[model samples]
Target: MGYLELALQKEKSLLCKRLGHKFKMASPIKTRKENRQVLYQCKICDQEAWLQWPEDSFNKLSENAEKSIA
Candidate 1:
């Protein structure tokens, strides 16, 4: 079960990267509640395109307009 979960997570991560490229959304960063932020490196661009940390943190790319373009 643990292995399956890990694989699923990996797949999801890859899918997100793909979605970002498809939508021209670059700089995938994750921010902590404590205000510390970490940038995500894109596999598509191995270098020179790290997503800004804590950038647009509240925005979501989902189909829900309330979240996508809020």
Candidate 2:
């Protein structure tokens, strides 16, 4: 990468760390969907991450736990 690109990447990393990542759906042309998984790309850092759908039972369990704690 060129110096400007490296500097931009560094800035993005710092912004993501301080403000949290802003994620958006990746373009369909670039990724294929998989069962129970969603592809996301961070707008600030241009990094990719995955989100997996949890089973119904697991979701309910977590919700209940949070409610009880609160």
Candidate 3:
């Protein structure tokens, strides 16, 4: 894979560790008029977020946890 793709995979792994669990899509993905929104949840932290397609929604939850801890 290219560097950018590799970096994104690494970031995703870090986010999983920070959140202390895996991510699950809250519902089946849907697309409408080229805009896509997906709901994601962290089982360990019970964090929920909605993010546009191709973005990392789990990172937001991990970032929030870091902020609260710091």
Q: Which stretches of candidate 1 lie over 4 Å from their true place?
A: 1-34, 45-70
TM-score, predicted candidate 1 vs. hidden true structure? 0.21
Superposed model 2: Cα runs more than 4 Å off:
1-19, 29-35, 54-70
Candidates in order, TM-scores: namely 0.21, 0.38, 0.38
The local lDDT score (0 to 100) that residue 31 gets in candidate 2 is: 26
Give the TM-score ranking, best first.
3, 2, 1
Model 3's C-alpha root-mean-square deviation from the true structure amounts to 13.7
For all the candidates, what are their Cα RMSDs to the real structure? 12.5, 11.2, 13.7
Higher-ranked by TM-score: 1 or 3: 3
Give the Cα lDDT of each candidate: 0.32, 0.46, 0.46
Worst 10 residues of 2 by lDDT: 1-10
Clashes of each: 1, 0, 0
Per-residue alpha-carbon lDDT of candidate 2 for residues 1-70, written as tens digits (9 for 90 to 100): 2221211244333223334655555654132234444456667667665545456644554465568668
Q: Model 1, residue 37: displacement in angstroms?
A: 0.6
